[model samples]
Target: MKLCTLVNKDCSKAAVLFNSKKRILEYISELAHQQLPDVSKHVILDALMTREKLGSTGIGKGIAIPHGRLQGIEQILAMVLVSEQPIAFEAIDKQPVDIFVAFIVPEGNNEEHLKTLAAIAEKLQDKSFCKQLRHAKTDQELYAVIQGDDNG
Candidate 1:
């Protein structure tokens, strides 16, 4: 599925002011609450914290995708944030992270999670796409970039 489809205008945020992973996860978890009402902030935090224990989700460059598998979740939920200041996430490339996409998927939906991660990673690799995302002036602009439609 397209990122814009999963991360709609309601959950997408631009120029998010966060300085650390804790704050970022808190912010994204709040957004996820809009999609999954049953998912408490603490639950999201635990998932993220647990995922970090495994390894840093910061794949490369200025991007980070933190994901977790939860037991009670029935569907996949995503939250995208563009930070006002890049956080010092221990990324694979050892660069600080400015763009983040956090995902919470059902425990049994491993394949779906992989597919979504692949799609997100592929899209993020495009220089133009990353530039547009970084330069986006508003949440809607960011959504347009994720949609990959200039005319939208």
Candidate 2:
């Protein structure tokens, strides 16, 4: 599973100005609704919030990956967002998060979902790559950074 396979140029956002996790999730919900209109925004938010209750998706290093499973979806959907300022995310490292990658996957596809999560994690582990992502000035630049050759 590749980041480009799940996220497109249009799904990438740069310099998102949200102050809280709830607000970020709201934006993510809106993106999910745009991609999966048949799935209710409430359902998307509920699933993501429920997952968060179990543990924070903020994996540290100024990054967070919030993901959820939905029943009606046939395939995985993803969105990438970069904040203008870091937001407190209750991450394990106790650092604020500035980069967010949200995932919505079809229910019962645990194998693929985990693979995708691992892939994203691996890609984000590169400090230089993350720096480029943070420096991206526009959505197109952000998308290019995410879809760059280093992702593999």
- Residue 29's lDDT in candidate 1: 73
Candidate 1 has a TM-score of: 0.91
Clashing pairs in 2: none
Per-residue alpha-carbon lDDT of candidate 2 for residues 21-102, written as tens digits (9 for 90 to 100): 9899888998899988998898999989999999999999999999998997898899999999999999989999999999
lDDT of 2: 0.90
- The candidate maximizing TM-score is 2
Query: How much is 129 displaced in model 2, in angstroms?
Result: 1.2
Stretches > 4 Å off in candidate 1? 149-152
Alpha-carbon shift of residue 107 in model 2 (angstroms): 0.5
